[model samples]
Target: MKRIVITGTSRGIGFEMVQLFAQQDCEILALSRNPKPVQELNLSNVTALPFDLASTKDLENVESFLKENWSSVDILINNAGKLVNKPFTEITAEELFSVYQTNAVGTFQLTQKVVPMMKSDGHVVSISTMGGVQGSLKFPGLSAYSSSKAAIITLTELLAEEYKESGPSFNVLALGAVKTEMLAEAFPGYEPPTTAREMASYIANFAQTGAQFYNGKLLQVSNSTP
Candidate 1:
């Protein structure tokens, strides 16, 4: 069975993706700050662990799990994200740093820890917001969240270049208007067309096969009209 690691698995897309992957013939490591949701699922091949992208201790927890239970990881889904909605002046350094800590630095560290355990054919799929895409439509009150996510886009390209010959590809998906808790928090009263389960279905498939055809690329996933 393929060994997979997915972050942000407590709820929303991450949680739904866990359910989707659990149906497949693979072992899943579901990481979230609140691991109880996933643990309750009690899937035979899924292990739920309390994880915080901003915490060094949580990173070590995942590493320890990998070193003990699995020989290699076939997929690493960087799906966890932190969002802060506020005016530029209202946003504090601490808020910005916290965003970057989870969305960028923590992701970088975790990927570094997992890459060595992955085969050349493994895949790293990072989730980003459409707002993070350069030249894309900008939104209000997401300065910290959007910019932090942008970092992963560039990081994905860099990692793909560095590991082109070694195998295991890196790519990012910049999503738009998904009906998620984070979306509601960022844009109140806005109704997104895409549902969490819908997005998870697509991401679940891509995480498994996208590496074969793509690497070091960013795919903007959106269906918003006008």
Candidate 2:
């Protein structure tokens, strides 16, 4: 059975991902600051933990769990994100730092912990936003969120080059408007064509086999226009 680790599991896409992965014959670690929702699911193959991507202690706990439970991880899905939908001028320095801390720095740090436990066949998938893509139609109040997410795009490419010889391919997905909590936060009352579960389902499938055919690439998973 494949062993996987997924972050931001309290709700939306991450929550759906945990459920879908649970249906498969694999071991999963589902993490979020509020782990109660996933814990309530009581899936036998899933383990829920209270995790804060910005917290060093929490990051270490994730590493500890992997070390104690599995020899190696097959997939690491960096799905946790933070949104700061405010005018660039109104976004305080601390607010910008927090956004980056959760979306960018945390992802980079977490990968440092998981990559060591992965083989060449392993896959590391990170979720980004179309807003993070340069020239993808910018929004009014997503400066912090989008820019921080953009960092992952470059990081993925650099990692793929660094580890190309050792294995464990790295790729990122730049998603468009999906009916997710984050999307609602960014564009309130706006409806999206895709649902959270639909995106999560696609991500799950990609995490399993995309590495075989791709590395250091960003796939734009959006059917809707900005």
Candidate 3:
């Protein structure tokens, strides 16, 4: 069975991804700030790990876990993220840093630790937002969140190139609006065309197959056809 590591598995798309992977017989290290939800699933293949992407201390724990328990990872999904909805001018430095810490900095830190543990043909997938892409949709209140996700896109691209010869493939999934709590918080009263389950299913399938054909690419997944 494939060994998979995924972040933000407490809820939303992350939670759904864990379920899908577990159903497919993968051994999953599911990380979340609160692991109770994952633990409650009680699946033998799912190992719920408590983690807070914003916390460097928690990152240390993640590194330690990988070193002690696993020699190699087949798939790594950097799916945890933070969102801040505020006007550009009103966005505080702390708010921007918080979003960046979770979406970019923390993701990079965790990936660096896991990269060495990844198999030669391993796949690394990062979850970014469609708004992060240049010339994509622009929203008034997503300045910090969008910019942070943009950083993830750039990071993934650079890592893919840097590690091209070394082995593991890197890719970014630039997802459109999904009916997640994060989306509801950012766009109150608006219904998203896509649901978290739909996105998670796509991501789980892509995680298993996309690495064969895609690397260093930003894949845009949306409800509407481009």
- For TM-score, the strongest prediction is 2
lDDT of 1 at 204: 94
Question: Clashing residue pairs in candidate 2, if any?
Answer: 120-168
Candidate 2, superposed: residue stretches over 4 Å from native: none
Query: What's the lDDT of the predicted structure labeled candidate 3?
Result: 0.90
Give each model's whole-structure lDDT: 0.93, 0.94, 0.90
The best candidate in terms of lDDT:
2
Give Cα distance to truth, residue 102, candidate 3, Å: 0.3
- Please write out the lDDT profile of model 2 over residues 1-226, one tens digit for every residue: 9999999999999999999999998899998999999999989999999999889999899899899988999999999999989988999999999999999999999999999999989999999999999879888899999999999999999999999999899999999999988898999999999999999999999999999899999999999865
Between candidates 1 and 2, the lDDT winner: 2
Specify the poorest-scoring 10-residue window by lDDT in model 3.
217-226
Better of 2 and 3 by lDDT: 2
Relative to the true structure, candidate 3 reaches a TM of: 0.96
TM-score of each: 0.98, 0.99, 0.96
